[model samples]
Target: MLINKAHQALTDDVVKENFLKYGNPDGPSDVKHGIALPKFLIDGPSSPFLVVIYILMIAVILPIFVNSWWDGVKSYTKLGLHVDTTTYFLEYLLNYNPAELITIEKIIGFLSHAKEFKLYKRSLTPEIVQKLLLSHINRTQLSPSEEQLKLQVVAIAPKLIIGFLDLAATFRNNEVCFQLVETHRCLIQALNPEANATVNKYKEILQLPGASLEKLDTTQPIYTLGKLLKKPTIDPSKFLNIENTKEVLDVAAQIPLIEPLDCKFTVPGESYVPPASTSHVDLRFIVKSPAQKSKPDVSKLSKEVIETQLKDPETLDYLRNPLKVVEDQPKMPLYSVPPYFPDVDYVRQHSGWVAFLILQKDGGKLADVPNYITRVDLSNLKLSPAEFLESKAIVSAYKFPLSTPTPNVGTYHFRFVLRHLLYFGSDLDIPFVMNIENKPVETKRDLYEIEDPDEDSIAGAFAQMRGESVKKFEHEYESSDDEDADDDEEEEESDWSDIDTDTEDESDEKK
Candidate 1:
């Protein structure tokens, strides 16, 4: 085969020219090579009948015949229980390259010569065959049935590493060969699922805990070369951060451990009484709870009563849980001087404690309006215990409709109420002014960290705005690529100079 290739290459001037110019005959030479037409076709006189028949048979008749067989075989094969092996075999043979026929003589000659070198005895043993099949199975793309066959082949095959061990034994007391065999054994156990499972089971039977094939360092040279021919054993723990005891304890310390307690309302502070019509009157105050040494267990306690009371102020609870209203309040009256426009937009803009809607009142004393109270509606809110604990309990919207009254405009007062979340807690009173005009309320929203001016101060703002253009600080590196390239060029120049000097000396000696 080698001799034939060399002879053909030597005969071809194009290949030689391309190699001299580009150092690569295959590189963009634009030379096309092909088998020439038969000598008879080119040299002999043409026959019209034979030509017509040959063209017709190959281009039309052959395709039609093949297509008919293909269609029939394909349709029948879809049943899966039966298939035409002859049709598939015919297809395979027909599709094979015609160039293969040219290699037959060379292959026959090579095989005849190979026996003189004792190459016939170099057949693969069962162990080596098993390894090759398993490696092929791990790397090749196979159909479901083909994969099943490969797996079955792997199952029936004998242990492959045993063959390597036997080969190693022949080299008696050779440390390198034994080491290589051991490496192969480790890699085989890592790549082969059946082998790995068997190893694990054996380890378990021997009480060898934590002996896992997955933990093998597959990146090492011995394992990496083996993995190229088989499936890789990737250690997932390499990507995971394995925390130490101290680090874990430090992380746990950051979490809040306080148990929450129901709180009592204190006096609310305000900058302005009856704040701007648009602004919500945020009645803020700190609540006090009984100081207990530990949180009371509410799981076994009755809903009707407090299990115990704190007699000492020093033993009062410190953790304050946010207060929530338990139920819905009846619609209240709205008396306004500007003829309270019973419009949805107006009502929505003016409403406070959004979970409850304000309704128009028919008859009520002006004094009773301020003190009117009912259970706050909490039906709209849906929250899990963890989320409720983490986040604030505030409803931002109420979808109730605001009905237009018969009267166009009049002085109105909507009685608003406040209720405690706990059954034992009392109703709280809040002060407000009546008969206000509708105004566009600027909604208050807490700024996200990214939007905060303090976070994006001048220095931070400049850093972010520059993006990738900003030069990043990197640790200094030794011997960059430019230095390496320069060194390589110098080495090549030196080598050429040495060669030139040797040639000149040789010429002088010849003279």
Candidate 2:
């Protein structure tokens, strides 16, 4: 019910605010008209919980000890994504902000009175959705789940487009209704959980397709009001017209309703198409640098090395768990690496403290470490012997199956993990995890269009690297041509056999 109510609350006031803040909130003051639906969802301040969440976000959560729930505000602040709902929820839990400048009444009223904001849901018109999504693809920051969602919606768009075609039959001003119908794709994509893809795809299409929902057919005169609601900015009073707004609402209701489309293809963000949700152990090994290394001695560890490893139960259990090493092959599956570390650090100076995280089956206590260890030295370069690496806690991670079928497994998926801990003065928690999956994917990517001399230089490097004779190239070329001609002759023979009775007689005679 709240979702429906919330859906109803997409009004002009909110729509105006959304575009102003999100799309271009600070643009020229004169062009105060466009779609008001998005703004209502964003800036109209309707979500009491969400707004309180936002204020609390600015107030309390900044001081919380957690680092990676919604991802810290530090890096996100750069990306400017905190304006959305994910971070807003996290703020509510960490920092309970009590004092409110804006009363709940005012907030809810703003949303209630705000003219209906548009939600480009996946209606029957999927083509409209695809055009919109592709158009905005360049601007949105969709998670891995989101990319899959984009593809799914694209595949499903045709079905949705046909749905709108049925709705298009009801309106008198077919142009206005049809125009809006045409843009069903963009609106549905905007509703997509893959916000980033929607935005980016939208930008792409805006350059070319230039299609919008303004083309669809509709059952009501809501198009004229839709124009008013689409404004980038509008006065609250302008949309607060209860009589006209209700009339528009009636019309919107009469038309074929558009509801939020759940992506069955996969979750929006990272496309984790697991084989069977079958549990498998994932082990990451980190080589710990000693507090002190005397010199490079392959035979023995340095005296400065803290021989006493973290003998904590969690740590011991992790190493004790038998790791089954998968057979390494030439082909590597595409894996996504979470942004474990912010890119704003002096990486060279970072310490070589790594973590070998183990995710157990059944999902509890995935991270064995404690919240805080005197391991500040383990995180930072400064080691006073007291701030040694301790048993600090790890955040929750995807757990593995309780019992694996395979034997003592080591890492088969990952070749190696090159990670460095990020030390913000005394903070040693943030770790950067970069992996060389198996080997480089592209060996000869930019071979074509290279100048002859450059090509020769590359060829020479290849020759020196592989120690191959220069004539090897010619031999392979000639051999390949001979093979092709022979293959052609063989194909001709096969073709003769496929012919009718004459061919059958020839085959019988040959036999």
Give all TM-scores, in the order shown: 0.15, 0.16
Candidate 2 lDDT tens digits, 242-334: 334444333222211011111111111212323222233232211122221122222232333322221112344343442212121111111
lDDT string for model 1 (1-511, tens) is: 7566455556778866665677655445567974255757745677555567778988999999999898767644322212332243223334544345322122112212221112213453434333435453233346776555444433222122223223323332123222322233222222222334443333211111122244433343222211211222443234111334233222222211122232221111312222232222223221111111223343433433232221111221311211121212333222111111113333222222211223335332222211112222332123333333332222221111122221222344443333221111112333333333333456577665233333235654676675523334343578788988998999999999999999999999999
Please report the candidate that would top TM-score against the real structure.
2
Please list the C-alpha lDDT of all candidates, in the order they appear: 0.32, 0.30
Name the candidate that leads on lDDT.
1
Clashes of each: 22, 92
